[model samples]
Target: MYENMDKEYVLNTYPRNYVNFKQGKNATLFDDKGKDYIDFTSGIGVSSVGHGNARLADALSDQVHNLIHTSNLFLIEPQAKLAKKIAELSGFDVGTFFANSGAEANEGAIKLARMYGEKKFKNKRYKVITLEHSFHGRTITTVKATGQDSFHKSDFSPYPDGFSYNKDINDIYNSIDDETVAVMIELVQGEGGVEPFEKEEVQKLAAFLKSKEILLIVDEVQTGVFRSGEFLATNLYGIEPDIITLAKGLGGGVPIGAVLTIHKDIFEVGDHGSTFGGNFLSTRAGCEVLDILEGYKNSGELDESFIYFESKLQEIAKAYPALFEKVVGLGLMRGLRCFENVDLSTLINRAFDQGVLILKAGRNTLRLLPPLTISKEEIDEGFKRLDNAFKVLS
Candidate 1:
């Protein structure tokens, strides 16, 4: 019924799987026909605390009854608390601007960067440099910011100006000029095939940009909130970005995005605002996610889980050397790099039909973004299903 209704009513934007999931718990999902599947994608890394977490459900329900949204015109307590918690966790005196999604969060970051550039360079600087193959967002501006042309090829004509891609430090140096305001990058280019930048190179780039007074914007939309085994990937790389954008797993499956900045005074009043950003319910969910992660961190469970998951990925790579060339990414955000000739889409579809849900990163990368709260048994089951899929594919 849902598939029929969706076909009739919804726009065909995504090439969706055949299954219509009706329920989920932890790392498991149930389709409408009651078939159970091990979930490795974590709703594209949004359900960090896992599906149907009772604590999050209760918090969201309570918030819904009390308040769902109170505009940015008024100060909301939950929003304030969540912001404070994020600041504390960030280890910096920072301010946050909430948005509805990663794209919006990144859009906010870009605007803030442009505004700061205007003030610092007397309106002479507005250009923002991003890395090659980086995926920022879907908005017109962000599509231009995205380094890949394939993403912006559909009706994205006359690309926005002031955004350029660089493949190396020399390219970046050549791109920089008096009008350069910021350099944006994803430490791990998640959608670009789970590729990570070299730590030393990133450090040198950040230092060089700082020397030129250019702001560093780190898009942590996929790598933040313990998804990378660290609270933030920037912390993992020891790079302190002037601005950071976060979303995916921060709200524990709830839709929320945030722009966090070390330089809080970059934007003043009347500079930015969002109608539904940091509303009561979303902030409540965000706070609950933080609370759950904090508890896990205090109990050392998160670290143990991270280690176990990484080791299992390494084991898989070693075991399936004929199929998988390598494993990339940090913590739970991992990718199994398939052999060059492998059809990753077919493999992912086969895995789905075999009662496992995974994702594709680039052309030959099978991405796994299991929930942080997923258990060892769930991980084992997920991998077992994946192996079964591989056997059928072979």
Candidate 2:
């Protein structure tokens, strides 16, 4: 079916880069004409357990029958279960706030950081320092928080003033004066092309923030939910972040996000709240996703998967050194850097035509965020498609 109807009906801001998706299952999607493509994008890091998982379907169906949205004014069972499970699984001091998306969770974290500063420092600290090239979300405040200045707009004018960015550890340290409330970072910068911070640099900066009594907030919105082999990417570094934000896979195919704080005293009723943050439906999906993670954790399947996946990716990277600058990332959330002057748009389109979906980040980096439940057969098929895409590029 022709999609020109979309041009008449929808807003033109999105750039509609591809055809409309008809249906998806596991790691594949079909278009209107029944053309199928391997979904390496994984809904940009959502869909952890894969598309059309029977368990997630059942959970959502059951919740649809029981309850959907109740005002946060009353207790909800699925929300409580999810909260408890996240706290237990995350090893935090046991505080969780739910939200509908990554940006909302990030907004919650920003508010919590400011509130913590107000309560502990008597309102002396309020600034948050982020790094250059970091991508948080699209909300006004998060857009301001994003390190890329291109996200700022004229009408969005007078962007939030407290957030700042620095290029190096020394600058980041020197920039943090008495008013700095928090330092937020992604251990592996995802949208910035899977740029992993140096362990030594992160350690030094973390130590400085701790010394200044500033909160360390890790934005794991793209790196969390076991996408990087660990439950949270921050765990790999052994740094104790005061606040951690999560989305993108927390509820499998469903939308959900959360902020987990180390201490519970920072937020008071009315200090922060969301109307549809912890709806029964999303919470039920979250609980089922947690159950899936729990099973994978106990059975040692995730460990094996990570081991096999990493080795395979590395092998492919080595084979095509001339075409790629490097392959960098943890586990399934990986990036491929093309040699300078390579047109990534052309390559991505070629991959799509050849039945593989890929994403671009930064300037010359191609990103792959496949579902955790993707099979070896899917990987082989996707790789072959990517190889064909590269052939066109070459």
Candidate 3:
């Protein structure tokens, strides 16, 4: 019914998995037919606190009863509180602008950088330098910001100006010019097969940008919010970016995006706004996610969980060298680089049939973005299913 209904009504944007999930509990999902699957995708990293989290549910429910949205024209308590919490956790004296998705957050960040360049340089610098294989967002401007050509190949032509891509530091240096306003990058290129940037290179780039009075924008939509063993990937790498865009796992299972900046005075009245951003329900959910993460941190459980998942991934890579080339990424955000002959889509489908839901990152990398709240038992079970899938594929 869903397959036919989706074909009739929904636009064919995604080649979705065959199963239609009916319910979820923690890292487990139950399809409409009552078939259970270990969910490693976490709805592409949105359900960080895991599915059916009572705390998030209660917070969202209470906000729904009280007030869901009051527009940006009016002051909202949850929005303010959530912003403050994010600022504190970000470990920077920052200001935040809320949006509805990662793309919107990045769009806001781009606008902020342009405004900052205009206000400070008075030279109308607008060009932003991004890395090759980076994925920022899907908006016209963001599609241009995204360095991959595949994302912009179709009818979205006459691509937006002021965006350039670089493969390395030399490419970045060459791309920078008098009109360059900022350099935006994803610390871990999640969609680009969970590729991680070298630490020294990132630090050097940040320093170079600072020396030139250029802003550094880190797209942490997929790497932030405790997905990388730290609250922010910047924290993990010790890179102090001027602006950071966050979404994906920010509101646990709810949709919320944010642009955080250390440059507190980047925006003025009427400079930027989002009508549905930071609504009561979304902010409440964001606050609850932060609370859960804080608890994990304080109890030393976050580190433990990260170690457990990392070790398990390493074991899998070592145990199955013929299938997995290597395992890359930090914390629960990992990727299994498959052998050249391996068909990732086929493996994913096989895994799905074997009661395990996973995702592909690039062409040959099996991306694993399990909930930070995933347990040891769930990890063991998920790996067992994956092993079974591998055997079947073999």
User: What's the CA RMSD of model 2 in angstroms?
Assistant: 1.7
**Candidate 2 lDDT by residue in tens digits, 162-231:** 9999875568878887788999898988988788888788888788788878988899998888887778
**lDDT for each residue of candidate 1 in 73-117, tens digit (9 for 90 to 100):** 998999999999999887878899999999999999999999988
Cα lDDT, model 1, residue 14: 89
For residue 260, model 3's alpha carbon misses the true position, in angstroms, by: 0.3
TM-score of 2: 0.95
> Every model's Cα RMSD, please?
1.3, 1.7, 1.1
Winning model by lDDT: 3
- The lowest-lDDT stretch of 10 consecutive residues in candidate 2 is 1-10
Worst 10 residues of 3 by lDDT: 167-176
Q: Write the per-residue lDDT of candidate 3 for residues 108-131, one digit (tens) a residue.
A: 999999999899896789999998
Instruction: Name model 2 segments beyond 4 Å from true.
Output: none
Instruction: Name every residue pair that clashes in candidate 2.
Output: none
Error of 2 at 369 (Å): 0.2
